[model samples]
Structure formats: structure tokens, C-alpha cells
Target: KKRGVQTGLIRTLESALVWVFEQFPGTEAALNDLLTQESGPESLLIGKGSEAEMARALG
Candidate 1:
């Protein structure tokens, strides 16, 4: 949603995440870590023209 790509189906996404966590148990922890590692909410002010923001967001 942040990058403005069109997407939907929340239940399917949730099921896919469950499948991923089941298939690779370690993946859930890494994803949890990413979710928890928050410095600030710079995403609210980001502009699409800058690739650096995208790179940082991905990292």
C-alpha cells in the first residue's frame, strides 16, 4: 500500500503468511524482527521520485 501498488484479498494473504511460517519456521521470526525494528515513521512523508527511500524501506 505504501508504494501504491494495487492489491487486495486479506484472507488469502494471511493464509499465505501462515503457510510460509509453517514451511520455514525461521522466517516468522525474521519477519517479526523487521516489523519490530522501527526508527521512525518516515514513510508518511516519502515521495515516489526517490529510490533511496524505497531502498531504505526494503532494508
Candidate 2:
């Protein structure tokens, strides 16, 4: 169950990154490569609920 949650968070974050890259042209290659590299957010696994709460609060 924990693994599932982590995987879901990764997928969601990946989708968001793709959307961001799509919205801003010319950054696609850079973002795609960065997203897969060690320096990317995808390299980390954050708890889902906390991130959601943070997003809501920021909004």
C-alpha cells in the first residue's frame, strides 16, 4: 500500500511536469531530461496528503 501511494504521487507529479513543459515551449527537452535526472523532483518521493495540503494552502 505504501508503495502504491508513492507510485501514484510520482505519476501525478510527472503529469504535472509534462503539462508545465507543454505550456511553455522550448523547455520540453530540458524539462524532460531534468525530470529524469537526479536533480529532478521525480527523484524524490513525497507524501501525497502533505503535498496536496501544501498546494491548497499555496492557492
Candidate 3:
């Protein structure tokens, strides 16, 4: 994939991660808000649980 597409996919997944986290219980909104604080090729660096959840969400 092109670097741009890779970056976009990463950002989308990361945004999804942040949204999922916010939908959960007891997370610092302020900190979770920081999830997408920057823009570019970055993901949440999430755990397996979140990764699975994200996969399901995407599917």
C-alpha cells in the first residue's frame, strides 16, 4: 500500500480505538481525548483485546 493509505488506515483504526475506549467504563476522557491528538501514521498501540474488538468492529 502507499504510505498515504497506510497512514489513513492507521489513523482510522486509532480513531476507532479511541471511540471504543470512550464507550467503555472509567477512562480518563482527557487522556482518551489525547488518543488522536496528533495526525499521521499512528495507532493506539492497543492490546490484543482492543485489537480483536477493532477487528470485529471493522468486520
- lDDT (CA) for every model shown? 0.60, 0.58, 0.54
Give the TM-scores of the predictions, in the order they appear: 0.51, 0.38, 0.33
List all candidate RMSDs to the true structure: 7.6, 8.3, 9.0
Tens digit of per-residue lDDT, candidate 2, span 29-50: 6545645777556433454346
**lDDT by residue for model 1 (1-59), tens:** 26753477777889998997888757777655545657333433455337755444444
Looking at candidate 3, the ten consecutive residues that score lowest on lDDT are: 39-48
Stretches of candidate 3 exceeding 4 Å from the true structure: 1-7, 26-59
Error of 2 at 36 (Å): 10
Give the number of the best model, judged by TM-score.
1
Clashes of each: 0, 0, 0
TM-score of 3: 0.33
Off by over 4 Å in 1: 1-8, 40-59
Model 3 over residues 1-59: C-alpha lDDT tens digits?
44456547888988987786668644545344545467311544535347656444333
Clashing pairs in 3: none
Task: Please estimate how well model 1 matches the true structure, expressed as its whole-model Cα lDDT.
Answer: 0.60
Sort by lDDT, top down from the best: 1, 2, 3
Worst 10 residues of 1 by lDDT: 39-48
For residue 16, model 2's alpha carbon misses the true position, in angstroms, by 0.8
